[model samples]
Target: MRLAAKANLGEGTISDFENGYRMPNPRKLAAMRRAFEGAGVVFATRGPTLTQPRWR
Candidate 1:
């Protein structure tokens, strides 16, 4: 269920996204952006350094 209930998308839609069977429409993407923005989520871009940490 969408938090604002304005998206009106079902769980099946989310499932399709996770399964790579469907993609988010531009409207949905805008709604998500609005939601995240209202929630104070900051998106940033950071480049990796010459020496990156290894997971292993």
Candidate 2:
């Protein structure tokens, strides 16, 4: 997926993180977070949810 490409990681690696099969290092996690934020994703601390930002 685009996230994998942007994170310079393999699709399988992203899948592993999503499926709870593995955990990424702090640096990788930060990279992924930045990528997602750039794509308009806003992370919420309530239950640690992912949501699109509301632009008004």
Candidate 3:
């Protein structure tokens, strides 16, 4: 819920994406990525990595 709020997307949109039913538009996807980054996630070439302890 927090991630969805931070990404400015409805929970349904994120749930759909997680279930592999749909993808958010590029703008929404970018917002999601930014939200993840703000939460201390690091996107790496190999895969996403956590750079620090989670805040929430």
Best by TM-score: 3
Compared with the true structure, what per-residue lDDT tens digits does model 2 show for residues 1-56?
47898777778888999999999999889988887776667777763444664333
Q: RMSD to native for every prediction?
A: 9.3, 4.1, 1.3
Candidate 1 displacement at residue 42 in angstroms: 1.4
Compared with the true structure, the alpha-carbon lDDT of candidate 1 equals 0.56
Q: In model 3, where do residues sit more than 4 Å from their true spots?
A: none
Off by over 4 Å in 1: 1-8, 47-56
Show how many residue pairs clash in every candidate, following the order shown. 0, 0, 0
lDDT of model 2 at position 49:
45
What is the per-residue lDDT of model 3 for residues 1-56, given as tens digits with 9 covering 90 to 100? Answer: 38899888899999999999997899999999999998889998999998995666
Clashing pairs in 1: none
Flag the better candidate by lDDT, 1 or 3.
3
> Candidate order by TM-score, highest to lowest?
3, 2, 1
lDDT of each: 0.56, 0.77, 0.89
TM-score preference between candidates 1 and 2, better one: 2
Where does candidate 1 have its weakest 10-residue lDDT segment? Answer: 47-56
Per-residue lDDT tens digits for candidate 1, residues 1-56, read 25334345666765687689989888876776555544444455673232332222
Model 1, residue 52: what's the lDDT?
35
